[model samples]
Target: MTQDEKGQLKALLRDEPSMRLHRELEKELRDDMMQRLLTVRPDDPAFAALTQFHRGCLHGLHELWGRREQFVKQPIQGGNDDK
Candidate 1:
Protein backbone atom coordinates (compact mmCIF):
# COMPACT_ATOMS: atom_id res chain seq x y z
CA MET A 1 0.00 0.00 0.00
CA THR A 2 1.07 3.61 -0.57
CA GLN A 3 2.31 5.64 2.42
CA ASP A 4 -0.48 8.22 1.88
CA GLU A 5 -3.16 5.53 2.01
CA LYS A 6 -1.58 3.96 5.12
CA GLY A 7 -1.49 7.35 6.85
CA GLN A 8 -5.12 7.99 6.05
CA LEU A 9 -6.12 4.54 7.35
CA LYS A 10 -4.20 5.10 10.58
CA ALA A 11 -5.81 8.50 11.06
CA LEU A 12 -9.26 6.98 10.53
CA LEU A 13 -8.57 4.26 13.09
CA ARG A 14 -7.36 6.81 15.66
CA ASP A 15 -10.35 9.13 15.26
CA GLU A 16 -11.73 9.95 18.73
CA PRO A 17 -15.33 10.40 17.57
CA SER A 18 -15.41 7.00 15.89
CA MET A 19 -13.95 5.38 19.00
CA ARG A 20 -16.56 7.06 21.17
CA LEU A 21 -19.31 5.94 18.81
CA HIS A 22 -18.14 2.34 19.02
CA ARG A 23 -18.13 2.50 22.81
CA GLU A 24 -21.61 4.04 22.87
CA LEU A 25 -22.97 1.38 20.51
CA GLU A 26 -21.54 -1.40 22.66
CA LYS A 27 -22.94 0.13 25.82
CA GLU A 28 -26.34 0.60 24.22
CA LEU A 29 -26.41 -3.03 23.04
CA ARG A 30 -25.48 -4.28 26.49
CA ASP A 31 -28.16 -2.13 28.14
CA ASP A 32 -30.80 -3.28 25.64
CA MET A 33 -29.93 -6.92 26.29
CA MET A 34 -30.17 -6.35 30.05
CA GLN A 35 -33.57 -4.71 29.67
CA ARG A 36 -34.86 -7.60 27.57
CA LEU A 37 -33.66 -10.09 30.15
CA LEU A 38 -35.35 -8.14 32.92
CA THR A 39 -38.62 -8.03 30.96
CA VAL A 40 -38.79 -11.81 30.74
CA ARG A 41 -40.81 -13.49 33.49
CA PRO A 42 -39.37 -16.73 34.83
CA ASP A 43 -42.57 -18.74 34.81
CA ASP A 44 -41.22 -21.54 32.70
CA PRO A 45 -40.81 -25.03 34.13
CA ALA A 46 -37.05 -24.61 34.24
CA PHE A 47 -37.47 -21.60 36.52
CA ALA A 48 -39.99 -23.13 38.89
CA ALA A 49 -37.51 -23.46 41.70
CA LEU A 50 -36.33 -19.90 41.39
CA THR A 51 -39.88 -18.60 41.25
CA GLN A 52 -40.88 -20.56 44.31
CA PHE A 53 -37.79 -19.40 46.16
CA HIS A 54 -38.53 -15.76 45.41
CA ARG A 55 -42.16 -16.18 46.41
CA GLY A 56 -41.13 -17.73 49.70
CA CYS A 57 -38.68 -14.96 50.35
CA LEU A 58 -41.30 -12.32 49.62
CA HIS A 59 -43.75 -14.00 51.95
CA GLY A 60 -41.17 -14.15 54.71
CA LEU A 61 -40.38 -10.49 54.25
CA HIS A 62 -44.05 -9.57 54.42
CA GLU A 63 -44.50 -11.60 57.59
CA LEU A 64 -41.50 -9.96 59.20
CA TRP A 65 -42.75 -6.53 58.18
CA GLY A 66 -46.14 -7.22 59.74
CA ARG A 67 -44.54 -8.40 62.95
CA ARG A 68 -42.35 -5.34 63.08
CA GLU A 69 -45.33 -3.08 62.52
CA GLN A 70 -47.20 -4.73 65.38
CA PHE A 71 -44.20 -4.46 67.65
CA VAL A 72 -43.80 -0.81 66.81
CA LYS A 73 -47.47 -0.02 67.38
CA GLN A 74 -47.50 -1.75 70.78
CA PRO A 75 -44.48 -0.57 72.62
CA ILE A 76 -43.04 -3.00 75.16
CA GLN A 77 -43.69 -2.20 78.78
CA GLY A 78 -40.96 -2.71 81.33
CA GLY A 79 -41.55 -5.45 83.90
CA ASN A 80 -41.40 -2.94 86.81
CA ASP A 81 -44.16 -0.76 85.32
CA ASP A 82 -46.83 -2.77 87.16
CA LYS A 83 -45.77 -1.58 90.64
Candidate 2:
Protein backbone atom coordinates (compact mmCIF):
# COMPACT_ATOMS: atom_id res chain seq x y z
CA MET A 1 0.00 0.00 0.00
CA THR A 2 1.12 3.57 -0.50
CA GLN A 3 2.20 5.45 2.61
CA ASP A 4 -0.88 7.58 2.35
CA GLU A 5 -3.17 4.58 2.26
CA LYS A 6 -1.27 2.92 5.08
CA GLY A 7 -1.40 6.04 7.16
CA GLN A 8 -5.07 6.57 6.50
CA LEU A 9 -5.84 2.99 7.37
CA LYS A 10 -3.83 3.26 10.56
CA ALA A 11 -5.62 6.42 11.45
CA LEU A 12 -8.96 4.85 10.70
CA LEU A 13 -8.09 1.96 12.95
CA ARG A 14 -7.22 4.39 15.73
CA ASP A 15 -10.17 6.69 15.18
CA GLU A 16 -13.75 6.25 16.35
CA PRO A 17 -15.62 8.56 14.03
CA SER A 18 -14.31 6.65 11.06
CA MET A 19 -15.54 3.47 12.64
CA ARG A 20 -19.05 4.74 12.23
CA LEU A 21 -17.96 6.04 8.87
CA HIS A 22 -17.09 2.58 7.61
CA ARG A 23 -20.39 1.12 8.74
CA GLU A 24 -22.04 3.57 6.45
CA LEU A 25 -19.37 3.00 3.86
CA GLU A 26 -20.02 -0.71 3.89
CA LYS A 27 -23.75 -0.11 3.59
CA GLU A 28 -23.09 2.27 0.71
CA LEU A 29 -20.96 -0.26 -1.12
CA ARG A 30 -23.68 -2.82 -0.73
CA ASP A 31 -26.31 -0.33 -1.79
CA ASP A 32 -24.48 0.48 -5.01
CA MET A 33 -24.49 -3.17 -5.90
CA MET A 34 -28.22 -3.40 -5.18
CA GLN A 35 -29.22 -0.11 -6.77
CA ARG A 36 -29.19 -1.37 -10.32
CA LEU A 37 -31.36 -4.34 -9.45
CA LEU A 38 -33.72 -2.16 -7.51
CA THR A 39 -34.02 0.26 -10.40
CA VAL A 40 -35.87 -2.29 -12.46
CA ARG A 41 -38.87 -1.83 -10.20
CA PRO A 42 -40.62 1.21 -8.84
CA ASP A 43 -38.77 0.59 -5.60
CA ASP A 44 -39.82 -1.17 -2.46
CA PRO A 45 -40.52 0.77 0.73
CA ALA A 46 -38.20 -1.55 2.61
CA PHE A 47 -35.31 -0.38 0.49
CA ALA A 48 -35.25 3.06 2.06
CA ALA A 49 -32.46 1.92 4.30
CA LEU A 50 -30.29 1.36 1.28
CA THR A 51 -30.77 4.86 0.01
CA GLN A 52 -30.14 6.38 3.44
CA PHE A 53 -27.12 4.21 4.02
CA HIS A 54 -25.64 5.20 0.70
CA ARG A 55 -26.22 8.88 1.35
CA GLY A 56 -24.65 8.59 4.78
CA CYS A 57 -21.61 6.90 3.32
CA LEU A 58 -21.14 9.72 0.86
CA HIS A 59 -21.43 12.19 3.74
CA GLY A 60 -18.80 10.38 5.78
CA LEU A 61 -16.32 10.11 2.93
CA HIS A 62 -16.72 13.77 2.11
CA GLU A 63 -16.06 14.83 5.69
CA LEU A 64 -13.21 12.37 6.25
CA TRP A 65 -11.48 13.37 3.03
CA GLY A 66 -11.18 16.93 4.30
CA ARG A 67 -8.94 15.66 7.11
CA ARG A 68 -7.06 13.30 4.83
CA GLU A 69 -3.85 15.31 4.83
CA GLN A 70 -3.23 14.13 8.39
CA PHE A 71 -2.59 10.68 7.01
CA VAL A 72 -2.12 11.00 3.28
CA LYS A 73 1.38 11.38 1.83
CA GLN A 74 2.56 13.06 -1.31
CA PRO A 75 3.06 10.78 -4.28
CA ILE A 76 6.65 9.79 -4.97
CA GLN A 77 8.39 7.44 -7.37
CA GLY A 78 9.60 4.04 -6.22
CA GLY A 79 13.30 4.79 -6.98
CA ASN A 80 13.49 8.38 -5.81
CA ASP A 81 14.02 7.87 -2.09
CA ASP A 82 17.50 9.43 -2.15
CA LYS A 83 16.23 12.72 -3.55
Candidate 3:
Protein backbone atom coordinates (compact mmCIF):
# COMPACT_ATOMS: atom_id res chain seq x y z
CA MET A 1 0.00 0.00 0.00
CA THR A 2 1.06 3.56 -0.62
CA GLN A 3 1.20 6.07 2.17
CA ASP A 4 -1.91 7.69 0.76
CA GLU A 5 -3.76 4.39 0.87
CA LYS A 6 -2.68 3.86 4.43
CA GLY A 7 -3.94 7.31 5.31
CA GLN A 8 -7.24 6.64 3.62
CA LEU A 9 -7.57 3.37 5.49
CA LYS A 10 -6.92 5.13 8.74
CA ALA A 11 -9.56 7.69 7.94
CA LEU A 12 -12.03 4.98 7.06
CA LEU A 13 -11.31 3.25 10.35
CA ARG A 14 -11.46 6.31 12.53
CA ASP A 15 -14.37 8.22 11.05
CA GLU A 16 -17.91 7.08 10.44
CA PRO A 17 -18.44 9.57 7.64
CA SER A 18 -15.28 8.38 5.92
CA MET A 19 -16.43 4.80 6.14
CA ARG A 20 -19.85 5.69 4.77
CA LEU A 21 -18.23 7.43 1.81
CA HIS A 22 -15.95 4.48 1.27
CA ARG A 23 -18.97 2.19 1.23
CA GLU A 24 -20.63 4.36 -1.40
CA LEU A 25 -17.50 4.23 -3.55
CA GLU A 26 -17.33 0.49 -3.16
CA LYS A 27 -20.95 0.17 -4.21
CA GLU A 28 -20.31 2.27 -7.29
CA LEU A 29 -17.33 0.15 -8.24
CA ARG A 30 -19.39 -3.01 -7.76
CA ASP A 31 -22.13 -1.65 -9.99
CA ASP A 32 -19.63 -0.72 -12.70
CA MET A 33 -17.98 -4.11 -12.54
CA MET A 34 -21.33 -5.83 -12.81
CA GLN A 35 -22.23 -3.74 -15.83
CA ARG A 36 -18.99 -4.70 -17.50
CA LEU A 37 -19.60 -8.34 -16.73
CA LEU A 38 -23.08 -8.16 -18.19
CA THR A 39 -21.85 -6.66 -21.43
CA VAL A 40 -19.17 -9.28 -22.04
CA ARG A 41 -20.03 -11.91 -24.61
CA PRO A 42 -19.24 -15.48 -23.61
CA ASP A 43 -17.67 -16.17 -26.99
CA ASP A 44 -15.20 -13.28 -26.69
CA PRO A 45 -11.61 -14.42 -26.29
CA ALA A 46 -11.24 -12.29 -23.16
CA PHE A 47 -14.37 -13.58 -21.51
CA ALA A 48 -12.75 -15.94 -19.04
CA ALA A 49 -10.06 -13.52 -18.00
CA LEU A 50 -12.50 -10.66 -17.66
CA THR A 51 -14.88 -12.65 -15.54
CA GLN A 52 -12.03 -13.93 -13.40
CA PHE A 53 -10.80 -10.41 -12.77
CA HIS A 54 -14.25 -9.26 -11.73
CA ARG A 55 -14.67 -12.34 -9.56
CA GLY A 56 -11.43 -11.55 -7.80
CA CYS A 57 -12.52 -7.94 -7.29
CA LEU A 58 -15.87 -9.11 -5.90
CA HIS A 59 -14.15 -11.48 -3.51
CA GLY A 60 -11.81 -8.77 -2.32
CA LEU A 61 -14.68 -6.34 -1.81
CA HIS A 62 -16.57 -8.95 0.18
CA GLU A 63 -13.54 -9.62 2.32
CA LEU A 64 -12.97 -5.95 3.01
CA TRP A 65 -16.61 -5.30 3.83
CA GLY A 66 -16.61 -8.18 6.28
CA ARG A 67 -13.31 -7.27 7.86
CA ARG A 68 -13.56 -3.54 8.47
CA GLU A 69 -13.45 -3.89 12.20
CA GLN A 70 -10.45 -6.17 12.05
CA PHE A 71 -8.70 -3.74 9.79
CA VAL A 72 -9.44 -0.88 12.13
CA LYS A 73 -7.55 -2.65 14.90
CA GLN A 74 -4.48 -3.55 12.88
CA PRO A 75 -2.24 -1.64 10.54
CA ILE A 76 -1.91 -2.96 7.04
CA GLN A 77 1.65 -4.27 6.58
CA GLY A 78 2.94 -3.08 3.24
CA GLY A 79 2.64 0.65 3.54
CA ASN A 80 5.53 2.99 4.37
CA ASP A 81 5.60 3.72 8.08
CA ASP A 82 3.75 6.94 8.70
CA LYS A 83 4.85 7.48 12.27
Which is the leading candidate under lDDT? 3
Model 3, position 38: C-alpha lDDT score: 84
In candidate 1, position 20 carries an lDDT of 74
**Which TM-score value belongs to model 3?**
0.51
State TM-scores per candidate.
0.46, 0.37, 0.51
RMSD values, in order shown:
24.8, 10.6, 8.3
- RMSD score of candidate 3 (Å): 8.3
Clashing pairs for predicted structure model 1, backbone only: none
lDDT for each residue of candidate 2 in 23-47, tens digit (9 for 90 to 100): 7776767678486547744477656
Residue pairs in clash, model 2: none
- Tell me how far the alpha carbon of residue 33 in candidate 1 is from the true structure, in angstroms, after superposition: 0.5
**lDDT for predicted candidate 3 compared with the true structure:** 0.76
Clash totals for all models, in order? 0, 0, 0
Lowest lDDT sum, 10 consecutive residues, model 3, at 73-82
Model 3 over residues 1-83: C-alpha lDDT tens digits?
Answer: 79998887777666888567767877877787778868878898677887788778778877876788676767568766666
